[model samples]
Target: MPSPTLTRVRQAYARIEAVDRPEVWIGLRPQAEAEQEARAIDARVAAGEHLPLAGKLFAAKGNIDVAGLPTTAACPAYAYTPWEDAPVVARLRTAGALALGTTNLDQFATGLVGTRSPHGAVRNALDPTRISGGSSSGSAVAVALGIVDFALGTDTAGSGRVPAAFNGIVGLKPTRGLVPTTGVVPACASLDCVTVFARTLPEAEQALAFMASPSGRELPALPQRAPGPWRIAVPPRAQLGELDEGWAEAYEAAVERLAAAGAEIRHLDLTPFTDAAAMLYEGAFVAERYTAVGSFIDKLIAEGDTGLDPTVAGIITRARDIPAHQLYADQDRLAALRTRALTQLGDADALLLPTAPGHPTLAEVAADPLGANARLGRFTNSTNLFDLAAVAVPAGLTPAGLPFGVMLIGPAFTDERLARLARLLQPRLRLAVVGAHLSGQPLNPQLLSLGAEWERTTATAPVYRLHALSTAPPKPGLVHVGEGGAAVETEVWRLSAEGLGQLLAALPRPMVLGQVELADGTHAPGFLCEPDALPGTTDITAYGGWRAYLNH
Candidate 1:
């Protein structure tokens, strides 16, 4: 019988042949070599040695070095064979993960749209008509399609996360410097992070551990788990103006899901974050991109080679004109924005955001490459600038049947903490808050303190009457009426049983926790009032919800 490891390797090669998308990979490891490595792993396993990633197959982005493969960064004229694997790739191989090949990337790792390469655009795994978000496009698509267990891509802007979002997979952009970049081509050497794309968060986390340097940077120990009742910051609704038709709704749905998972929702102004994103290309950061390969590109231009992506060439060429003083000035401005953004996020466990503003189609990007690609990076570009760790996870499908994703971002070394929080984003028991515990309301912090997460804003089942009670700070009393009732808006939340018990123990008179029916025909434990209290209450159902009544 063939060795199990060798069998898996053969299967992977077979799948690659079936995928038939030449654009996704720039180079692939020879099948015989991979099978030989697999046999060695099987031999070790038979000898009682344990290899965690024994049968795993992975790919490296073209910009990253993989022994015997050319490091092209999608520029054929700039390609060169690397003698050794980058440290990250070397570590993964050491852990028994096989490198299948170097995947395609945006030339020089300059664009987010994934189309800036001589190799054809890497198509989306789900919708071929749409772009597979790029510079890390092929890495993400490979993982999404299960062609590999995991893949490596460098994130300078949103290269890592955008591709994951568009392709429906997990993208973990580790804290910059956590993974060594010794053998990888530089896009922005200062901000570049070796990112990992995997089908799931746990797998990505495991891969990241194998890739992280053990002693180079003395970093904080990753938290085993983030303590419950996490404070997850989100931007105000207005900040999401760039989201596509169904994307905003998709994001709101994701926010609701996070809340239902027991996170405290904190509204933060994203001006600082968005401003930092703009600085990546609009400021001196572009000069860093030039510093990476501008001279080589210039040499090619001098030699009359037109193979470089025109858009990428134009971007680097423009950076040649930025003065040294301007770079320093922009650096200072970035420092200020980073300080302000982090300050605004004070006390929050992590910031949750839509992975990308929207998913764009190939046609959309083709019509306006620069503008569409810039928009794709709107939410992702500032991560490295702020020195944060980010993990992008597939949220769900949009109304248009396209994939949507949300990212969990935290301080530079909070990778583990963000991972812990990401697990909560899955389905969980829900609770409804009709009044006092609504987000931004007076009593909302109480629920937050108890680790209750706000899920989504919804309404009752058009069979409840709302009233204003005579109390301190004022509270709304929801009463279920068999007939002649109105739908009262409510917020859904998730809380642990311990948290729910704590909340129940502190309830004031007449307010009780009971099953409340929602407009969507779902029922959840929610705030209700004893009917006896109606004698002294003033009916306020006409206003719809507590906030509306207060405003009136």
Candidate 2:
């Protein structure tokens, strides 16, 4: 049986079709397609599947190939048919996830204002009058509305992170080349990265892990899964621009939550970061985007029937004129700016910044497309351009009900450390974890030991089983058996780096950390045993937790 949460997800997808918004999708999978996927996932689970995101439904940004689906890329004039799935899509498919369909994006991955698509603008789920930030517009909406557990998008310059924040979700932009762009359309081949959008951090992280390549996985061989009082950097008050008082308040609340949980938060001047952001478009990078689609875009324009997004066309038009010498000069400047930004980061565990400056309405976006869009990318555009890895976590909603998000950015390969910190900060966050650290048990303490704060106001989906393993000192293994497990009660927890290290070092042999899908239809790191440990061990799926099993 599908977990109630997954059931609800299915029902929500059904309802979403009634209020179909083509602006968010270029091509949506039919009911039969979704049903076919569900049956396959059920089969995997029935056979004791061990894949990440098993049974999860996700959508690919239209720029990616999904095997049998056309890559519209929000531009009908530039569609292509690929015989095979994109690398990331194939990975997700292999993990037993169902592809809901392909979503719309900013045409050619060119704009942040969602409206650049030929399909139409993707509206923010919370407030339809508002714009869903882009170029990964539709992917964010699908996740925010629960139409899919998570969605895939590509980010060359904040396309992934911006839309995520606008739609109240987590957007994770891994290190460049980490998720493989082999099957994905390129905006800037060297800079483009496939990203994940989801309602919760755990979901996004789970998708990221499934998609992460060893070559691009930048996590340190840390001590363990422990969160600590991390030294975090933030935008200096002076550098805070374009005020959204509500976002400011939520940002402060997020800071307070971290402080309450013992994190050392520091405010630092982000002047250098601002400078780097300017370099992305103002320097050589814009030319890179032009170079990426130069021939295709040029051919269309030459035919005089180029219906490219006007703004995208304008951006590309400018790229056509840059001299090679000027491009080299800009590249040299980017190097200096990168050094300065890193120096500002200066050994802090991670830099914390608003995922977007504030939310902009569709009206505001339509009126001032470029400015409104740049405001959203102020903190994010510099990431990939400077070779940084980042993870955005929901900070909570502002008093005005707008979602506030904060991101932890680190030098390449720091995703593991950042995830640890985001976990510890979850209470101050509205994010959920459907993984192994569900609280009020031994494993729960492992989360606490890793600096994970609990959100008492929340609960998980009850889709997993609690197994009492035969390991020393004992450990409760929560596995998503999608078969006969009861609704297991568990708490969601967040952690930081120092905390992650401690938990990892403390882990005993035979009990390793692996992915687990929680009752909430989300995945998290949980206690996993190498097959050798399960023999002769009693199957305690009836009891939701180790404590419950022992009590009986």
Candidate 3:
């Protein structure tokens, strides 16, 4: 479970205290603002006023204006004091959520890697060595750290999703315009979307529903049933380059799972998608960002903003060269390309792909700024670029213990269908525990690495025996039998098939991967005992669960 909430918001404030690193935030809310909001939430709960978000706290990306704070987008010179919150922020506020602060991002939301900000490189919370994907860096990290329950970020070419993937959280990029951007700093205004990041799919979706306008905007309906024997496409095999082998294997397993769940999978040409991505900078859409942040960057440079990161300047500089004539041609080509690409995906419920090719370190991003950031945008850049909606939910971890995720992309207004599919797939999160493997364990570096969430589960049924294998790395195995059985305590991990595949392959001899039946009669893949490896092993099932054995 996440850290327990505080009736006094100030108690919860402890999580926000400075960590060893600082890049996730550009600035924070005033002490008075935080205190007042916390008090207000407490009062509502005491008075039984029915707070929608209850104790939820959130942070907005730097570019979105929030009341009582500066909207800097990481450039101090470009700061502005807004009198009111952005429409989305206002929506969250009305829903009873407290605003924590403003988070760090690539200056003017120009880069995908978190290192492009002057505040500090947003390091991965799980492994301080890796980059916390961006430009929604701070928001995603904030949630990952449990300092906030949910956060608001922006997505244009993967800004929101990348950070979520990096931080091992759920990043929900709503359909274009699904959430208002009235007070936001636009990356590609026409393509920008205010996205959500949370620990689970339901939390993100709950915040999204609460984000609806008071006027009660109608949501798109979920497809009534399975996409009717749909023909879904995976990315072309040749372009799966630079991907971590774990992600590729995990993704393939996900494909198989989907096929089993009644969706047809196929491979389709990715030329159109790549062609569109090339147009983002190579074409005129660069001007849209300039139109949004260009004026500010120009003023900051003139007024002497020493805080603007160099790479941000370089990225903004490219926007200056996009000619007006080229924009029309690019738009025309984009329209045609989108039609072809959508047709390719039209026969399917949604497209599937790895959220990122691979995770990288902040140092790697710093060494080669543009290329590394671009590589992180592999599956994500095309979503908002083409005005499609995407929801990235946890698939689980690869054998290497790295988090792997898959995103479902669909046409505009299909947020409901996308969300339904995401929920239907939510049960895939069964997680098993040994030692600190339980929720809130300190040794869960791998859990944080793959963003494996803690789950509710029961022990394997009475047919299994638990044995602590004296293996070097330390692991346990479950054996099945009709006699001499004990109900061994175990955790059922809800994993993405992609994460399961790599984990399965890494099983050492004497320990085989197989299914274990749970107390509830549900089965999740787990470590089964190889008859050969049981020698010298102690049957500790009497302890009930591995946690009990470890505690003793």
Candidate 4:
């Protein structure tokens, strides 16, 4: 019998077939192949093996190899069949993620707008008339449309993030070299980083963790940030550039929301980051794209195959005219600017910015392809250039109902930290419960009544001391004593503001909801007792958790 996961995978494939947008995919795996993979995962699960992504479906940008699919990079002339999957894709497969197919992208992954592909521009999943930001257009669309659980995209100059913003999804651009690039087509070999698109921050993080390179050459351990008052840097108003009226309003509103959520918003001059962004295409970095495929382009042109997109071909051709000294000069300038950028980020946990200046329509991009595309990169291009990790998340919708999004960027190896911060911006709040409210406990019904969903089983940071308060029900109170505390087992539950309010209203004295530090240093609203009450309570800290103490 087919498992429920396999059944869902089949339904997803059916939905893909039913959709009208053909250009969203360049190559789709046969239904039989996908089904087989799903069944294999189900069998593994039945046998008691744990798979982080068991039965989850995913798509890869055509630029990345997936064994049976041709790696086209959105240019048919450049397509080649690979005998093995890209290292990242192989890792996902090993984690039990099934491949749906290879999705479309900008030709040679050269354009930020999706229209540059000869296969046809990928339409926005929500509104077909608008442009799906690219060159990761199709991958983002696949996730947005619910055709896949997550998808792999490549980011050199914001290809991964822009698309996610436009599609109202989470885009996680890991630090460069955190995930292996082997077996993937390169637009800019040195600067490129594989990225993930998913519906939630945790989902994207999970995918990234599995795909991240273990060699640790440039893949330092992902960083964690303690949750509390987060210091976030924003660009000065004058440097925000021109934005669509809806987007402009949305950005300001987003900043206000973050401030309300206890974030310290600091306005700063963004010239250093902006200058580095200019260096990507306006300076010597364009030459790197040329170096990657210049000879192949030259060969195609010599054979009179004018099938390549004119803009892509023109961009590569111009690189040949750039003096070698100009490349070195740009490198030197970039190195100095990087230092300034780092200095500007001092004391700031992350830099929060609009994902893109505006959402343009298909007609607008068709009118001035290059200019419109360049504008989309205003906030994104500087990221990979500065070796930053970023997560683009949906903020809300524009006045016209188009999706508006923002990005959280941090220094290298801070990918997980950025995701943790991004979670706070989401509508739901994650609360860590250590005592009676844990799953299967008496108070668990309170969570279920408020529409709360259990998220995961975890442990508190060793800095927490757990005490059993003297009450009729005997609840546990977690206190952050800074040091000499014990790690306690806990459960995380997600709930809405109204639900949280209900929970707060029902709370008894001495046991109030406050920030509790997790083992990873991230904070969540959890059960904490007043310092005065801690002295009279029995120290159940040695018991590790409420359940353990109750059993004893």
* Top TM-score prediction, candidate number: 4
Q: Judged by lDDT relative to the true structure, which candidate is superior, 1 or 2?
A: 1
Which parts of model 1 have CA positions greater than 4 angstroms off?
Answer: 220-228, 427-552
How does each model score on lDDT? 0.87, 0.74, 0.75, 0.86
Among these predictions, the greatest lDDT belongs to: 1
Q: RMSD for all candidates, in order, please.
A: 15.2, 10.6, 10.0, 13.7
Indicate the residue-level lDDT of 218 in model 1. Answer: 79
TM, every model: 0.77, 0.75, 0.77, 0.78
Worst 10 residues of 2 by lDDT: 427-436
Better of 2 and 4 by TM-score: 4
Model 1, C-alpha of 270: deviation from truth (Å):
0.6
Model 1 clash count equals: 6
Model 2, runs deviating above 4 Å:
1-12, 47-49, 215-228, 428-552
- Between candidates 3 and 4, name the one with more favorable lDDT: 4
Give each model's clash number: 6, 29, 14, 2
* TM-score attained by model 4: 0.78
Superposed Cα deviation of residue 108, candidate 3 (Å):
0.5
Predicted candidate 2 versus true structure: per-residue lDDT over 1-552, tens digit per residue: 665325544775775776577677888877766776676677667688776666578899999999888997777888888899988899888887878789988998887878898788898888888888889999999888767778999887788887877777778888776788888878888888899987666667888888877765455564342455687887766587866877777777777776776778876678777887877777767888777787778888888865788788878778888788987887788888888888887767788877887788888988887778777778888888888999887777766777777888888877777877776566432223323444544456666654567754333345555556655556665555555656655555555433443464456656666665554566555455565666676777666555566678
Instruction: Report the backbone clash tally of model 4.
Output: 2
